[model samples]
Target: MSTPSQLSTNADLRILQRNMAAALMQPLTRHDGLQSRTQVDFITPNDRLSGFQRLEIYARQYWFRLLDCLYDDYPALRVLLGEMRFHKLCRDYLAAHPSTSWTLRNLGSQLSAFITEPKARDVARVEWAQTLAFDEPQKKTLHIDDLLGADPSALRLGLQPCVIALRIDHAVDHFITAMKKTDADVRSGASQAMSQAPTRAAIIKAPRLKKEVLHLVIHRHENTLYFKRLTREAFLMLTALRDGLTLADAVELALAEADPTTDWPVQIRDWFAEWSQLGWFCKPSPQP
Candidate 1:
C-alpha cells in the first residue's frame, strides 16, 4: 500500500544505516562513506531533529569503543601517562594506525612498533612489553622431582608456552615497576628524567622464584616453566654447552668468568645434575 515516495524514503534510510555501520567499526572519517550531511539530513521522520544530530551519536560511539580497546591493552601505559597525556597518545596512535583490526586484542600488537616512530619512539617498546608480559597464560607449579626419572645430561628444555622473549629498546623491568604504581607519571628516582639513563637489570617474574633474583633463562618442563638464573659463568657455561661443546669445553667457557680458583669438574658435575633434574637433557634413545 506504500507510495513511490515512501519506498524511496525506506531506501535512503537503509543506505544511511549501511554507511553508519561502516564508519563505526573502522577508522573511517565523516567523509569516508556517504556525505555526512546526506545521511544526517535525509531522514524519513518529519521531526525537528536534523540528520547530522542523529549521526553524531554514531560518531561519538566510534571513538569511545576504540578508546576502550586501547585502554584494556595498555593500562599500565595509561597509568604512567595520566589521563590527559594518555588520551592524547591514543589519539596519536589512532591517527598513525587507524582501527583496522576486527577484534580488540590485536589493536595493540603494533603499539610497541608504533612507539618507534618519531612521535613515540621512546616509551613505546617498554610500555608495550609490560602490558603483553602477562598476556601469555602461565602454567601450574611443577615440582623439582617431576623430571627425576629422566637422565640428567640428555634432555634440553625450552622456553615455556607462557614465555615470550622481547628485546625492548628500553629496559623492561624499570618501565613495568614504574607503571605498576598508582600515580603512573612519577618517574623512578631523580636519575630517570630520560629513559636512556642507567637503570635496573632485567628480570621478569622474579618475585615468583622465591630466592635471590639475577639473570638467567626460563623454560617449561612437567607442566611448569621453571627459571634457572645464570651467573655470568653459568650463562657462559650453558651457552657453550648449547653450542655442541663437550662438558669440558663448556666448563672452560665458564672458567674465565668464574672465581679465579673455582674447581672445574665439581662445577660440571653439579651443573649436569641440576640441568638433568630440570629436564635440560634427555637420553639418546638407546641404539635400536
Candidate 2:
C-alpha cells in the first residue's frame, strides 16, 4: 500500500531502532555512545541535552536496571565481596553473559560459572538453586502412607520439585545465615547505636572460611526456604534417589559409607521418616 520511498524510510527507521536498542544494552561509555549515535541520524538535540547525551541516559538506565536485578538475587554474595568488588563482578558477568530471557528473574542464571573465586561461585550456586526451587512448579508431596503398602526394596522414589542437593567446599550456608541476621538487625532498631558509632577504615580481610566439604539440602516449605545440613552418607543416598536409584540400592550405599560407630540403620530410618513427613519426596514411579 505504501510507495517505494515510504517503504525505504520505514525500513531505515526499523534499522535505527534496532541499532539504538543494541547500543543501550551494552555497557555505557562516551566512546560507545558516540559510535551508537553515528548509526542513528534522526535524533534531535533538545535545549537541555544533546542527542548523544539523551541516548547515554537510556544506556545507563539499561545497565543499572540489570545490575539492580543481579544485586537483589545475590545479596549474600555482595556482602561477601563488598560493594565495589561485587559491582565489578556484576559488570564483568553482564559483559560476558547478557540477559537473553524475557524475565529478569533469570538474569543471574549464569552467574555461578562467570564468578572466578571458588567460594563466591559456590555461594552463587546455592542462591541460584534457591531461586529455582522457589519458582519450581508445584507437585503433590509424597507421605509415609503412600509407601506403607509397597515393598521398600523395589520402590524408586521421586524427589519433590522444590528439593535441591548441593555439595560445596565452604560453609556458605552458615555465612548466608549470619549475613541475613546482620541485615535483619540493621533493619530493626536493635543495631542503631552500633551503626551510628565511628566507622573504622574498611579493611579488606577475607573471612576465615572453613575448607571442608558441606552437603546441603535446600527446600521450600510453607512458603519459606530452609537449608538443611546433611552428612556425606545421607547426601549420597538422597542424590542417588534423585538420580532414580532403587530404594534398596540407595539405602545399601548410604549404610556402607556411614561411620562404623554410628547406628546407620536407625539413623536412616529416622531420616527417611522425618523427610517423608516434611514432604521431601513425591509419589514413587511405577516399577519397571
Overall local distance difference test of candidate 2: 0.73
Tell me, what's the RMSD of every candidate?
A: 12.3, 7.2
Error of 2 at 80 (Å): 1.0
| Deviation (Å) of 55 in candidate 2 | 1.6
Predicted structure with the largest TM-score when compared to the true one: 2
Per-structure clash totals for the candidates: 10, 0
User: Tens digits of per-residue lDDT for model 2 on 1-288?
Assistant: 111223358776676667777667666553334344343334568999877777666666667667767766777787778877887898789878888987777889999988879988998998888887776755788887787777767788898878899999988888777655221111111211121211223534445556678998888877678889998888989998988888889988777756789888788888889899878898655557
Segments of candidate 1 deviating more than 4 angstroms? 1-18, 25-48, 75-85, 95-103, 117-123, 130-135, 140-143, 148-158, 182-288
lDDT tens digits by residue: candidate 1, 1-288: 112333358776676566555444444343333234344333444387455655554555556556656765565555445566666677567767765656555666677665544323334543443343334444342333554574535543332233333322333344434445322232222321221211222322222111222344444444433334456676666665555555456666678656767776676667656765554543222333
Query: Which 10 residues in a row give candidate 1 its minimum summed lDDT?
Result: 191-200
Reference-based lDDT, each prediction: 0.48, 0.73
